[model samples]
Each structure stands twice: as structure tokens, then as C-alpha cells.
Target chain A: MKRSICISALISTLVLIGLGTAAAEVVMIAHPSVPVDIVEAGMIRQIYMGQTTPWNDELAIAPVVIKAGPVRNEFLKTYIKKSSAQFSTFWKKAVFSGTGTPPAEQNTESKLIAYVAATPGAIGFIDHDTAAEGVKVLSIE
Target chain B: MTSAHKSTFMAVLAALLLGLAPQIGAQDIAIHGAMSQSFMQTSDNNYLVESEDGSFSIFEMVLNTTANIDAKTRIGAQIYGREFGHLGNNHMLVDWAFGDYRWRNWMGFRAGRIKFSLGLYNTTRDIDMVRNSILMPQSVYTEDFRNVSNAFHGFEIYGSVPVDRLGSFEYHASLGSAEVDEAYFLHDVFIKVLAAGGQIPPSLGFEANLDWAYSGSLYWNTPWEGLKIGGSFVTSDLYAEESFATPTATLDMSLDMDLKKLYVLSAEYMRDRWTFAAEFQRLFVDIVVPDVPVFVPDVGVVLMDIPADDRRGGYYGQATYRASDLLELGIYLSVFHPDWSQRKVGTAETEQKDTALTARFDLTDSWLMKVEYHIIDGTGDLPERLNPDPSQLVKSWSMIAVKSTFYF
Candidate 1:
């Protein structure tokens, strides 16, 4: 009986750790020229919504996003407070109405890093461990 | 341009955008499209199309591309083709094309053919996959006069102002001209109303010129998440003229109408997997006809003026739930008062009530299908020609609409 209980505990721990990894800590990364080291939570939403755009008078803003997946789900739920469907619908309206267009999407974390690192006006989020050189990390306040 | 020319133009433009965006642009350009087909059937009455016996006349295809040129400036356009019964008759047109420049969170400018916002969903009417209902509440969104109310050729200014800890306020205002070149029902309504006022002609046609319109809306996003309240208003002048073949005599007949006032109150609350929305709107119009000679059957020509005022209003409450990963459900109750000033005067002629249920199924990541059922009471706004006689029209009717869309 004791051996069974120990086995159950070990399995539960492993499952919890796996779930945590699926929703790992996300870091807001941007091009080096983006004029911010840290961004407010509300401002991030606005930026993605195309409301708070422009790093300066001369530079335009670009918001990069991830394709549908566990990491994408966790990031949208934590920051945007919207489901993937709702986000897509909102941008669909914008696109069809000629009001706005959705941000570009990168299918993988490495691609997201590479795009943001190379683009001058890109802003995106990725797993903390995946943050690499050439991109600025904006800590959410 | 002619509809054929427009169709070819849009098709070629779409091909170019899809084919050349990669090589021409230095930044990012995204293209998206949706194809939708629908079937609608009504039990006792004909709706948008000849729905009495089931119709497959509803179809739409749209292609759009947006290019983020730099940051503050972006340009986008959509090529839309639709076949709705006898309305569009399979024609492609430019739905909206505009260049947008945002100066800040509180200010942005758009110039071109901009889709004017109405209540909440008007601007997005052409987007099929965004809503679960195959047809929105007809009382609030009459599909017959779609082209006249779809967009305006002008510019608009919109922005959001956020208040610290209190939420935000968004506003949109536009000034533009609107024309009704081929609105079947609107034309029929005028002819019927004129006939009721005692004018008989062999054949008649109507030309409506909406001189200039000003529309504005303000929405308050409360501190509470997923809650918003807003109001919208539109004002315009419509000058209409009549042309007819008298056959026996020359007739001078003309009329003018003004959209004196139009307003709406809207509210919506959305939470996880659930959304509740409601809106109420009213339109006040005044019509004036100068004393004109009318061709009478046997009594010869006579002259009279038919001046009138009309009030129309409607309200609807809706709720939608994302039932699961593959399905969504929605229901709404819509009430319309055709003659708001005499709302309770005539049971069937003055008011209408519609109860609708909708189910949406997601077959795949790119495909969705929706089935909707509606139970309707009263004929408040049904066109007189659809039924042989408006006075003898049935008070109860039902309809079912099924649609599928592939979007990308």
C-alpha cells in the first residue's frame, strides 16, 4: 500500500511539472530600437490591438504573434484575456472593415526570435529560456 | 464602373496582391479571404430573397490584403462578390478600401470608402465567419437596403481615450455622401406610399440621392472587463425624384425626404465563452411632395401634395455561448415598431417580433457552418409586393437559414 501511494505521488508531480512547462514564463521581446525596456500590462494589450503604436514619431510599430499552440494559448490568456477564436474574430472584423489588419504570425519560437531580432519595429513574446541576442526583453509591470 | 468591369478589376487586383506582395513590399503584407454559401427557406413569407420555397441565392466571396507600410501608415482593401436573390445578382464590388494613419492612441485618420459603423455589427456585416447567426435580427439590420447603408465615400476619424483605472472611451465620426442606385425595396416603398396618397401612373421609377451624411458614435468601456455601453447617431438628407411613362399626358411629380434623426443605444458584456448584447435604434424621417400633376386612369390629370412623417424603431437582446470546442449556440429576441408614433395602433402592421436560435459548428480550423431558425410574428416591415395584399398577410411565419464558410 505504501509503494502504491509513493508511485501515485510521483506520477502527480510529473504531471504538474509538465503542465507548468506548457505555460512557462513568457518574456516580451522587441527590436533593439523599440524605446522601452519594460512595458505596462495594459500598454501591451493596447499595442497588440494597434492602439498604442509607434516607438517614436518616425518609427512604426509591428506586433508579432505565435501560431495556435500551448504557448500561444498561455500567452493570450495571461495577457490578452481573450480566447484564440475571439482574437481572430476581432482582427477579422478589423480586416474586413478596412479599419486594421492583424499582426504577423511566426509558427515557432526560434522563428519569432529571429524575426524580432532582425526587424526594426517588431515586438513579440516568447518563452523566457528562448530569449536570445539582438532582441530587447521588456519586463511586464 | 459597370459591375463586370468592377468584378474584373477586383479579381485582377486580388491576383496581383497575392502574387506580388512578397516581391514588391519591403515590410509585411497579409492576404485573407472567405467563401460563404447559404440556403434560406421561409414558411409563409418571402424575406430578403424569394425564400418561400427555399433559396440558394445567398453566396459571398471576399478577398482582402493589408500592407503595413512602415508603422503609422497602413493601406488595405477588400474585393467582395455576392449573389443575393435578385439583389446583387452575382456582382463583385469594392467593399472597402482605405489608407489609415494613426498619430496616437487618441487620434487616427482614414480616407477612402470607409465602412461606417452602426450599432455594433453593421461595419462587419460582410464578414461571415465572425458571427454565429446566418442572418442577424432583420429588425435592426434589414438586408434589403444594404448597399445604401454599407459605406460612404469619404473619411473618418476614430480613436480611444483611456482613463486611469476607469477604462476607456472610443469615438468615430465620418462625413460623406451615400447613394441608393439600386435598392428595390426602398423604391417600392416610395411607389406604394405615393399610390396610397392617390397617384396612378403606368410605370414609375425612383432615383434617390443622399446628398451628404454625418454619422458619429461614442462607446464607453467600463472599468469592469468585457462590459461596454455606447450610442450612435446618423443624419442625412435624401432628395428623390420620380420618372414615369404617363403614355397619355405629361406628369410632373417629385418628392424629397430627409433623415431628420437616427440614433441607437448599445450595450454588450462578454466573459469566458459567453457574450450578451443588446441594442435599440430609431429613425425619424420627413417626406415632402410638391403639388404635381398625376396621370389618372379615366378622370384626367389631377394635382396634390403628399407630405408625411414616419418613425421606425427596433431593439434586440442576444446571448451566445461557446458550448464546446466544436460548437457554439446563440439566441435572440428582436422587436420592431414600424410606426413608432402609432406602435400599438395596428397589431400586425405596426409591430413585429422575431425569436431566433442559431447553432454554429466548426468542422475544421478553416471551415465553419451555421444553422439558424427564426419564428416571426407580425408583418410590420414586410414589403407589400412580397405578399399579394399587406392587409391579408399572415401574422405568423417561420424560416430556416443554413450557411457554411471557409475562411483563411
Candidate 2:
């Protein structure tokens, strides 16, 4: 009976560890200068779509994006109701027609942060945990 | 003419200049091109004789570059060339050449071949994909006429102002010259009667005429969200000089004809995926033909009478439904009434009406396709040639067209 109990305990412990690792893997990050109020899924979508054209209420909005990847896909699917492929196609049409410009892209989260920091009108998204200096975390609801 | 050869030579020269120019500043030049092919089926019942055909191609290329002349001023130029199959053709031309002095976003001055900022349709009219409908409004911008007779060579002053956090207002005023030559003719035979009338004096031989036209528009966004109002006025003092000779006449005399002035007012309301727009326009023409006599060498002299001035006005309303981000459906109706008192010969003293339904599908990011069908009816006393039977004074026609545009 003791031996069986020990095996059951070990299995439970392993399962707990797995769940902990999964939770820890989530990344959080934001631009250092941005206030917490502006980080929302709708605002992010607006910025990317070129509908929100000002950084502040008084300035024009400039939205930045990262190249398509696993994380980027997850974020867009959850927030923008579109896939990266769809976004690319949409912007391609808009840009060529001179209606609007597409969001600028960087290769990685760090690069996105750097871009948003240097450009005042710029907004960008990164992992939740990477919450680093100079980037603000927009809420994605 | 030598103009064609000269343009070819100029193209070669431009290529050579591009190759030899030094790459020094941050300025860059890029070349872009697009090609599209479409098929159409039409019925003569609408306005003109309609037919069915396939595989027409439209190709265009643009060379664009921008440079900073100084800290406060920047200059840019774009050279464009376009070719249309059998239906129409557009030659190579300078699309834009302008110098910008940007004190700030609120104000600026641009001098060159500036864009006509008259209406929402006018600004992005040249970009095929920017429009939701494949066919633009025939009354505002006719495909055949705009292809050759559109645009101007001149300067413009434009600026924008933000009004207390509600929305911004933008205005542009331009003065320029447009040199255009357009010729159109129709021939029809009625079962019972036959009548025909063309431009009194044929339009030929007279060139180098000067044109003065002006356009201004003001746009305001209301604090009440989702509503925008704008109005534009365009007036042109354009004339063409032509000379015609009768079968027995010797001396070629000059006849001066004037194109009409036009004004347009537009208002739009947008809420999410739904947009409603309406526009009203007035066209005024003072076409005067002087009294002249024709002498036949073998016969005798005949007195030719001239017609009076012509005036026309119309209004159109459109509703667009965005089914999705990539698909749109639109329905529009237009009514036109021409003053027949000004018509010298043929009988067209009535109101003409046109109604159309259109569907647009964005097949891919770079490819767009559109299909439209139009129903046209003519009212009042129709010309004998236009009406085959005396019992009927009205005629109707239907037309169907499909266009596909691809961009690269």
C-alpha cells in the first residue's frame, strides 16, 4: 500500500511541475513611456488598422508590428480576429493603392521595443513577461 | 506625328539620366508597373451600341522620386505611362511635379502639377484598387473622357486646420490649364425615320488653345461622430477652335466652341461597415455658333444656321454595403435633364435617366474584380434616329461589364 501511494504522489508532483513551467513561459512586456491605460486589444487593432492615427490625443498614431511568427500569430488571432496571412494581404492592397500605409515590422520583440521607444507616435506589442523599460503594455481584452 | 518619336527619344534620355546620376543623398527612385485584363458583355439598349468581348489589357508604369532641396523644402516628381486596349488609350505624361514647403501639418504650399482635391473620388481616382466600385460614376468622371482630357498643368495652395479636438478641416484651391481633344460620333438608322446631327463644324486643325479652370473644396468633420460634410466647386473657361468646309467651299473658317462649367456638392455618412454618399452637380455650357454662308463652286451659295447654347444638370445617390473587409456591394441611381432649347438640329429635348447595380470582390490582396449592370431610359421627344417608330418617343437599353485589376 505504501509503495502504491508513493507512485501516485510522484505522478501528482510531476503534473504540478509541468503546469508551473507552462505558466512561467508566458512573457509580459510594454514600452517604458506609455501609460497603462492605452494598452487594450481594441486600441491595438485600431492602431494596426490605421484607424487610430495619433500617438497621443493631439498627435497622429503610428503603429508598429513584428514579422509573422508563432507568438505574433497567437496575439493577432486572440485580439485582431485575423491571421497574419490575412493582415499581410489586407495591408498589401491598402499600401499599393495609396489609401494607407501598413504597420512597420521588426524581427523580434526587442527590436519592436527599440522602434517604439525611438518613435513617439509609434505603438507596438510584445510578450507579456518581457515587460521591459521604455515600452508600455497595452491590455489585450 | 513627330510628337510620338520625340516622346520615345525622351524616354531613352530619361533612362540614360537615371543610369548616370550619382547616388549621393538619401533620396531614391523606384519603378513600378501593373497589368490587368478583363472581359465585357454589353447590350445596345443602354446608351450606345453594346457588344460582348474578352481579354482586354491595361498596362501602366510610374517612375517616382523625392529629394530634399533644403531643410524647409522638398521636391518630388512622378512620370507615368498607361496603355488601354481598343476601347481607349492614354499616352505617357508627367503625373506629378511639385515642391513642398511644410511649415507644419496645419499649413503648406505646393507648386506644380498638383492633384485635384475636389471630391473623395477625385483624390484617389487613378488608383484602381482604392475605390470600392470597379466603375466610377460616369457623370463625375467618364472613362473615355477622363482618360485623355483629365488633369491639369498648374499650381495649388492647400492647408488643414484642427478645430478644438472635434475634427480637422482641409481645403485646397487650384488654378490650371487643361489641353484636351475629344471626338465622338454615333450613327443609327430607324425603321421609319432617319435623322443625324454632329458637331456643326468638325473639330480639327485648330490646336494650342488655352484653358482656365479652378477648383476648391472644404471638408469638415462634425463632433457628432461618423458624419462628414464637404463641398467642391469647379469652373472651366475652355474653348476649342475648329474649321470646316462644305463640299464646294474653298476658304476654311474658324469656329470657337466652349465646354461647360461644372459644380459638385457631396456629403458622406459612415458608421462602421456602412457608408452612404450623395452628390449633386450642375453643368452649364454656352456653345455659340456664328451665322456663316457656304458657297458651292459648281452650284450656288447656301446659308448655314447656328444652334443655341446647351445646359445640363444631374444628381446621383449611392449606398455601399461592406459584406466583409474584402467584398462590397453598391447600388446607385442618376437622373439627367438637358435643355433642348439649345439643340440646333436633332430632337433630344427630354430627360435621360441611368441606373446601375454593381458588385466588387477582392479576390486576393493584389487582385480585384468588379461586375456592373446598367439600365438606361430616355424620356421626352427623342430624335428620329434615336426612336425607330414614331409611335414611341422613349427608348431603353441595358449594359453589362466586368473588370479585373491586378497590382504589383
Top-scoring candidate (DockQ): 1
**What residue runs in model 1 are displaced by over 4 Å at the alpha carbon?**
A1-24, A128-134, B1-26, B194-206, B241-254, B289-299
Distance from true location, Cα of B294 in model 1, Å: 4.6
Q: A25-126, model 1: which lDDT tens digit per residue?
A: 788999998888889999888877767768888777778898867777677778887766677778888877777767779999989989999888789998
- What are the candidates' interface root-mean-square deviations? 5.7, 12.5
- Report, for every candidate in turn, its global Cα lDDT versus the true structure: 0.78, 0.54
Q: Highest lDDT, which number?
A: 1
Error of 1 at A39 (Å): 0.5
| Candidate 2 residue-wise lDDT, A1-141, digit = tens | 999999898656643532321211223344454444446555565557644433444334456777846667666655555545446645654343222446678998788888888865566667666755675554444
Score every model by TM-score. Answer: 0.87, 0.66
**Candidate 1 overall Cα lDDT vs. reference?**
0.78
Q: Whole-model lDDT, candidate 2? A: 0.54
Q: Which digits, one per residue and each the tens of the lDDT, describe model 1 over residues B1-408?
A: 633564467556645654554575525677789999999998987777778989999999988887776667777778787888866666667777777888778999998767777788889987888887988876777776566567776889999999998899999999997555456545554567556745545445445666688899999989888899999888888776666565566544566768887787999988877889999988888877767556678998687666666688889999997755577789999998878887778688788898999998888878999999999998887875566466657889999999999999
User: Candidate 2: which stretches are off by over 4 Å?
Assistant: A1-141, B1-33, B45-75, B78-90, B144-149, B181-210, B242-260, B289-308, B340-349, B379-394
